[model samples]
Target: MGGSLPRSVDDLPLLPDLVAPQAWSADLVAASDGLFERGVRVLRDGEGGLLVIGDAVMRALAQDPAVGGTPVEFLTGRAGDRVRRATGAAPPSGAAAFDAFLRNQVFTMNAALHVAVRRVVARHLVPRAVLGMAGHAERVLVGVLDEVTRVGGVVDLERDVAGPYVTRFWTDQLGVPAGAALRVQQLVHEMNRMFLFAPTLEDRARVLAATEEYLELVGRTVAMAWERGDNALLGHLARGLDGIDLPGAPPDLGALVAANFFDGFHTVAVAVANAARCLLADAPAAERVRRAPSLVAAAFTEGARLTAPLMLTTRMALGDVEHAGLRIPAGTPITMAWIAANRDPEAYDEPGGYRLDRPPRLGTTFGGGARICPGRGATRMLGEVALRALTATSVQVRLESPQPGWVPGSAIRRHPAIPVVVRRVAAA
Candidate 1:
């Protein structure tokens, strides 16, 4: 491996078949029920990773006053040689590997550069993203529905309406070039599978090549946006605020763009679709949101709690850690099951139910601690705005197929297509 990015052989292993039944199931998280119900708080996976579950461990891992702030390093291994070998750079077994690792690390999650890049980029993205969802939200969503109605009003909900809406916001508000959002999303996702999840070396080689192509494409896009100097997120990073480069040079143009679009595309899109799925599943619930517009955010939050868009995250123990009776050795790879943790019965009255009245900031849908998702506010806003706009119309929202299911990607839970039929309601 040239760079050290793959999490584990298991995380994003090449699928045995193209599509798994679990991916198409009504309940996406159902596959993990047994793991979630294990009597022990921590279970060892075959790959030597630790699986943390239930209310107690989740609390300790996420929010224990004493251990809550413990540093869990991001997953990266000695793939420096791999990157060097793959990219054909002169390298021996010394600093070459480390340097290669850092180079590859820059564009990925849990990078040394992540903090600085996020600090710079969020300052620009957050405000505009909120504004896009606020000011142009109605217009943006109207556009989505119009597209939905155009194709006979029958869609897989996820691929058609929910998926496109995220890119539309990026293009319309974030200054991403028109018609480039889809391609950008495609490239970013290929990278994201490597960045956020684990893939085999063979798979990594294939995707990493595409990810490099993505980086190149985004780099060019960022250059144009930088020259334009628009107030969009891209411009802000290009403007170079927050002393981003200093101490260490700032991330390259493509990494910055990858930071924005890669995660933004599917995470928020799946979340929006999840909200729509939850809303459509219950007429009364959708009606409640329609009646009390303010609760739209709650609907999105609830949907995320049930169907986490990015279900699990890797956290490496900084040192030997003990919480209650469980002892986690230092340097152990701990997989935080946000989905299982969110659904832990101890945390919620009815963990699996789609009720929108839960306490605010209830779960790790957007992560927690130092690594809390910078775009949570924006994600919620996007979902709320999109859902609000859709429900505003008197259209029937239902499952597209007789048996609806989620698409298979353990790293990112999505529906290959959640078919839906939207017909106008008859006037009284």
Candidate 2:
């Protein structure tokens, strides 16, 4: 939000690269502090360079059209050019290559195009009847939790509850086959590597191979939608709604289907896990949620605020732009620091600590302004349902292991398998 991206590491003090894949949450917290303490809103971090932080700077990114026009057109998307120069292997194609032209298609289309597609996507996510939809998710989640507790309350919460719970919701609403949720989750993880810090040739090649299989699965589900014929997510999208025109609907509906699946699954699952982990840590909040089910939505937002599922986003400069008084030239690489902005002290009280009473409206956890995530409503609903169900279980959620064995990825902080034990209340 602060300024145009620094062209090179030399543009500013060689601040520790906050965007590096190996970099942990601690690194980001320290880096955010240094940037604000030193009064530099932008710096190139290790692995992934040229990060913009601070609330004022993020505001600049939102208001200025140049910073966000098309994500891949900017310096960040030139990994292929770098690959050709280094390895002599041809760059990837299709979704694997993270094609420059498609970047513009991803977000920065004309206002009309954004409106047309967004309407369709938003309908499923932010339904007119919130209580009705949330009730369905809650019912499904209760069934899932009952099954898990029946077998034994000891299970990997990340995989068993967070994922399968949401997966069942999609299946019920979209009318897809049962047990395909884990497969979708695996494919989305591979596909998301493209957005991480300069994915290696191996990563690109792997995604290229998976893209074929991934699209095949999306097609299978689309066919499944034909069988179900319900007004769920896949059904509604496959036939193409009346108002959405040709351009609004993707020529390749499978690809669009895959994209929509990607949008909600990982982010929502991670948010669910994070909230559970937070509530476990703060038992008081967990107990409060148990007493008042309505507080689940606020807890979900807080969980995302603490640990953003998608931490960093890359944007390119369309032309020379001044941010926080620094001139970033055309074609410079700029990384948007969603994680750092979420923790900005100016924006929230006790930004570091877990505060259930903290305002839910702060930070870019789901993004800000026009760039706000469309899946936000769905994410919150899924999380609320899952957490709400947990409160009713009359059990204590404790970490299976002392350590949070977080999975390493390009940009995403994933909760792959969280071993947790839920002690049931027999007296109840």
lDDT of 1: 0.60
Q: Could you tell me the lDDT of residue 48 within candidate 1?
A: 58
Candidate 2 stretches greater than 4 Å from native: 1-27, 45-49, 69-111, 127-130, 192-202, 232-249
Superpose all Cα atoms of candidate 1 onto the true structure and report the RMSD in Å to 1 decimal.
Answer: 7.9
What residue pairs clash in candidate 2, if any at all? 1-57, 1-58, 2-57, 17-45, 17-46, 44-50
The TM-scores, one per candidate, come to: 0.77, 0.82
State, as a TM-score between 0 and 1, how close model 1 is to the true structure: 0.77
lDDT of 2 by residue, 1-428 (tens): 34344544356644554333335333555557656665667665443446667776776676576765454344334656655654677766665323422432335443556556666666666656444678888777777777777888569886778877776676556555666766876775676665544456887777666656666675567666766666555666554544556453455544565555555665677678777777766778888888887888778778777778777766656677776456777766677778777877767777788777875475687766565677777777787777776776566567776667555534565655678876566655
Instruction: Please report, as a residue range, the 10-residue window in candidate 1 with the lowest summed lDDT.
Output: 64-73
lDDT of each: 0.60, 0.64
Alpha-carbon shift of residue 266 in model 1 (angstroms): 1.9
Across 183-286, the per-residue lDDT of candidate 1 in tens digits comes to: 86666456544432323455455555655666666567766776777745555556664355544443465555554555676678778887788787778888
